[model samples]
Target: EPEVTQTPSHQVTQMGQEVILRCVPISNHLYFYWYRQILGQKVEFLVSFYNNEISEKSEIFDDQFSVERPDGSNFTLKIRSTKLEDSAMYFCASSRDRVDSGNTIYFGEGSWLTVV
Candidate 1:
């Protein structure tokens, strides 16, 4: 089965620094997303992309966060300025279609980000 893959399994950064997390979603999937889970909290949706544009986003996905599909296979999330509260496990996910359509979402192992 196809799966999402993420890079830099873990990263440590200073507050106010910028960091880019990379991902390769299932090749056949058309919808992509980014989610984050702070330690001890539930997973939160950050943003969703389809047809090369953002379909939806949460308030947490403010100006500091951006997503891009620079090439056909690579999707990336850039944090312009990291904050201590930004520390969390960032998950890259994808689905053949929207969840409402009954398609399942697949997630990567996640990139753990730590801000100091």
Candidate 2:
């Protein structure tokens, strides 16, 4: 089965530094999203992208964060500046249809980000 794929399984960065997490969702999927889970916190939705634009974004996606589909095949999340609170496991997901269409979303293994 096709699945979402992420790069740099894990990353360690210093506070104030920039970081970019990469993800490649299922080829046939039409919606892409970025979510993160702090060690003991709930999984939080950051942003959702479709048709080359963001469909939705959570409050967490502030001035320091951005998402983009630089190429037709890969989606990415960039943190302009890392903070200790930014440390978490970021997950990328995709679905064959719109989120409101009841399509099952497939997630990537995860990219663990550790900021110190």
Candidate 3:
């Protein structure tokens, strides 16, 4: 089965530096999403994209963050300035359906971002 994949399973960065977390979503899926779990907290949605534009975004997706599909398979999230609070497990998910209830979203193992 095709699965989402993320790079640098773990990363450590300075508090103010920029970081780009990479993901390669499933080949045939159309809906893509980014979610983050702050240590023990529940997974929180950041943004969802389809048809090359953002479909929905949560408040957590603030000005410092942006996402792009740099190629047919690769999706990326860039944080312009990292904060301590930014440290979390960022998960990339993809689904066949745009609606959540219609299909199951598959998640990557997650890229653990650590800012100090």
Listed per candidate, the RMSD to the true structure in angstroms reads: 0.8, 1.0, 0.9
Give TM per candidate: 0.97, 0.96, 0.96
Greater-TM-score candidate between 1 and 2: 1
Off by over 4 Å in 3: none
Evaluate residue 87 in candidate 2 and report its C-alpha lDDT on the 0 to 100 scale. Answer: 96
TM-score of predicted model 2? 0.96
In terms of TM-score, the best-performing candidate is 1
lDDT of 1 by residue, 1-116 (tens): 77899998999999999999999999999999999999999999999999999999999999999999999999999998899999999999999999775899999999999999
Deviation of model 1 at 22, angstroms: 0.5
Cα lDDT over the full model 2: 0.94
**Please, what are the lDDT tens digits per residue for candidate 3 over residues 1-116?**
88999997999999999999999999999999999999999999999999998999999999999999988999999998899999999999999887557688999999999999
lDDT of each: 0.96, 0.94, 0.94
Better of 2 and 3 by TM-score: 3
**Model 2 worst lDDT run, 10 consecutive residues:** 98-107
State the weakest 10-residue window (summed lDDT) of model 3: 95-104
TM-score of 3: 0.96
